[model samples]
Target: MMASNPAILPGDVAREIIAPESYAAWDPLLDTFDHLRDTMPVAKVVAEDDVFEPFWLITRYDDVMRISKDNKTFLNNPKPVVFATREATEFARAATGSNMLVDSLVVFDAPIHPKYRKLTQDWFMPRNLKLIEGEIRALADKLVQAMIDAGPDVDFVKHVAAPMPLHVIMQILGIPEEDEPRMLMLTQQMFGGQDADLSGSGMENMTPEQVLELVSGAVKNFEEYFAGIAAERRANPTDDVASVIANATVDGEPLPDRDMAGYYIIMAAAGHDTTSATMSGAMLALARDPEQFARVQADRSLLPGLVEEAIRWTTAVQHFMRTAAQDVEIGGQQIKKGDWLMLNYVAANHDPAQFEQARSFDASRSPNRHMAFGAGAHQCLGLHLARLQIRILFEALLDRIDSVELAGDPVRSSSTFVGGLKTLPLRFASQ
Candidate 1:
């Protein structure tokens, strides 16, 4: 769009940016980002194999923030909202007849986005979330007790982090308790398919085509499951979020089948997975820093800071793609119309320019304006719920455990998209 040949990222760096394994090795990825932000903050990434389309990688904090807030200039549609290979993109288009595999709020822009978001926006706000506080706290306590009962040593991610938020969101959606495991499995396959351990699908040994097939299968499974829920809610409406979506209207007409399925899938999957990742991250950080954990345990007020810092520290949703609607200058680089850009949250959140001592897990960082929940109209709808879940879980955890330390080396999920600790082995002493 700009020139016949634009400056391309170095092969090694470009590979690292797109590689799923790179995200699991967190420090090195951050180091790569640090180097990029210092030298070429806005670099074009073109895969060596040409598996994926070229997109401008935005690593600097200010530039990412500007692009995120300026959704008007950077539209989410007509391109995959998340990074996808050319093959995967084609598969999605062929399957759904749309740019995305799922046409949810994350992939919409402008006139349609606001309408869909408003349907459940009030339900996710702080005041409304407060109505569910008791329920969430009770669930947190139950999970924390179970963790304590099994601990002295336990995998925190398995015992506590993963299930607590899942249960809460499921309850809110009016899903039966028996179906949560199915939901969790589908979510992992959808978002964690790159990681063999998480997906349980031997993805490491699979070809790209095989991996795409596995993910598409997961999406199909989700749609089929939600279809039943939507039908039931339509027939017998309830106060749950599912009923809200089932009966919602756009321009006085019911949501089309695809949109309805997309809505349910995003809510059911994203509602807990991101929160689970952040919770595990917070526990991992505190387990590593005994002093910080002790300080938060003593001062209940610091729990808020701990939660906020963990969201910034983990940045579960690693990156989201945006398409340029018009020619513009960003971070001293000219972006041409229709060009794709990656808003790398992990890079921006860890940028030393924005956060002093960026790598350190400091719970007391005032004005921790991190891009974890993103910004502007597309900001995560489940943010308030995420924060609340983390706070309550930690509150219950600290109340029951006198001390906590790593029992073994933690393992992170190898995913370029939503990812965090998949295994967090910890030893704790009961209070």
Candidate 2:
């Protein structure tokens, strides 16, 4: 028999594990995850200050994979799918009458989750997305050309990383090119609410209520903006993702306004940031390792590994919280019914047992079972698009990018979840 709570993390370690600032520094965060994996791979995160509810923190590769595959036992519903502070959860309850702020695909359980996810699932598959290959390549080339123009020295994030996926996803959504910046800003505020750099809200010294208010306001804007699109699409339906969503039905009725809005927000907001993060991460990894960059540059076939390793290296989605439906055993530890669990992708992806020299950013790492795009039934729907976007972007880059290296310190976003590099300074020379 295993213990009910295997081991509780020390107060300082526990707080740092959830702290937004701690995530900003990559080394310390990795150190914390490493320590957890070594000591209590399946430990309880008991916070005395109660910043968030107590949950089981799953740090090992095997445990996270098992929980992800057994979705029936580990539920996304009845809990916040993504991590939420106790204050934020209570705030959401009072405001939206739900435990979550948005009931998107990320929050739903099976039966309902499958039905909603199936709506746009085909739109993201490789067979369907292949039709847009030319468009993706063109966009990728354009961004790379922009990068070339910005060099011999430039900020890759601005010149290339941010815009490629933004344009691609926006194109699929039928958003006009000019409004992409506005879309980017809203998405940043929504996901990066806690990070002052990402939110642009100067969120210094803000309380939980204030953060909720700010995020709520952003969601409102997204809803209002998409509401008009939803109405227009219903009136004049076209062959776009938004049109599919606008006219989509479940149980013989149109999706409710809130659900419909959630669909739009996921497509418009959640689509690009992760890809952008991976793109920046790819550049960062290559910029730091010239030999690896040269290898990929010369071979060209290693582009897939480059793309995948970047996703794994970045592990941009961070962690998603799950609620245990019944008492279960995992990693020589015990769990109980109704217990919350944090499935940390960062720790799982970087686990040395799963990946050789996991922290070294090996662009050639094969069989890379990274959970950056998640796994099982709830795996990221837009993964093909992400891969295509990254592959094409790097294809264009490798063609012209003679060299790239760090110019100044790269800064990561100060956020507990859904974040990556805020600014990456690079010095590059194009042939």
Candidate 3:
């Protein structure tokens, strides 16, 4: 049963929730979420111009966690897993006959999702990741040395954070070093297309359809490029994750072409970007607070906490959409069947109810149950890898750098999806 009248967000606020530009101006967006959490935590967001579909915005920590953990009640399919404009939704449906352009683990439900996820599940586990520890550390050292050589002033995001995880994940996928730039560009266009600086495609001036077309083109390029890699791995199987996916069997049969491509795309794009974002955020936080930076540097044991706090503080993947399977009561409101919901991770991670001094980054914060990597079945598969990458990179950074401070204003990516500091200028001295 529905309520006589569901709460609706004001037009300006609703627009801010969906506007990509709002995310770049980070503090203001958090202020918006703070206001929403106090007044209308679960209000409905209807686009003023009807450009996008209407959905309930879940702003509280408990509500977002509940929805994230209950994948069945909150279905990922039959709707776009990520929010899409009406035009973009139709464009995806007409092209792929699905609500999303990329049909990866995030877009799957039930039986299929678990089956697909198990293919490389062990490989991402901490124990299995130990096999690549040296490789990751070496990459970290090289990047950190490059940062030192380029110091006392450098763009940490450009020189260190961005390339460390990108190189590591590329190696895990058996991608040659030469082809990494192409992969990076495609990933930016796919996830950061809303930002002109990231996409470099002038997407801010483009219509939704035009922006989507650019994203689709990036997907096509990825498929074509990975298609050849898949062929090579199939004929000559190796120990890499790419080979595992290429030769994986769901039900005693090889995976379909689309599913295989989807698997590769997710690994190639997500495996790196989210980790990079967290790394950049951690550095930015350390730069801003020299005491915290010195504390972690002097006490190596605090590295893990720093990594975890960074993930929570940055919350790179801001929000994800989930559709209701049936009518239900949540947050003192009735959610009807098939209603779309936005699990705003940014809000959940920053909720005062869940975290003390939610706005501030505290490495020592215990019981840190953040939804940055999400939860339940669709929780990020590479979470352990992400943690490992950040820990090792920061370890190298702390060992090499004696002190660090901000050189200029940091710039966040204008992406409502996966985003972090795109530019982190810092002045540092070598130990």
lDDT of each: 0.93, 0.89, 0.92
> TM-score rank, highest first?
3, 1, 2
Cα lDDT tens digits for candidate 2, 13-113: 88888888887887888988888899889888887977788998898898899999899999998989888888888988887888887779988888999
RMSD (Å) of each candidate, 1 decimal: 1.6, 1.1, 1.1
Q: Show pairs that collide, candidate 1.
A: none
Off by over 4 Å in 1: 1-7
Better of 1 and 2 by lDDT: 1
Winner of 2 and 3 under TM-score? 3
Candidate 1 structure quality by residue, lDDT tens digits, 332-412: 678999999999999999999999999999999988999999999999999999999999999998898888999999999
Error of 2 at 203 (Å): 0.7
Q: Compute the lDDT of residue 214 as modeled in candidate 1.
A: 93
Q: Distance from true position, residue 24, model 3, in Å?
A: 0.4
Model 1 clash tally?
A: 0
> What TM-score, computed on C-alpha atoms, does each candidate reach?
0.98, 0.98, 0.98
Model 3, TM vs. native:
0.98
lDDT (10s digit) by residue, model 3, range 39-143? 888899999789888999999999999999998799999789898989989999898888989999999998999999999999999999999999899989999
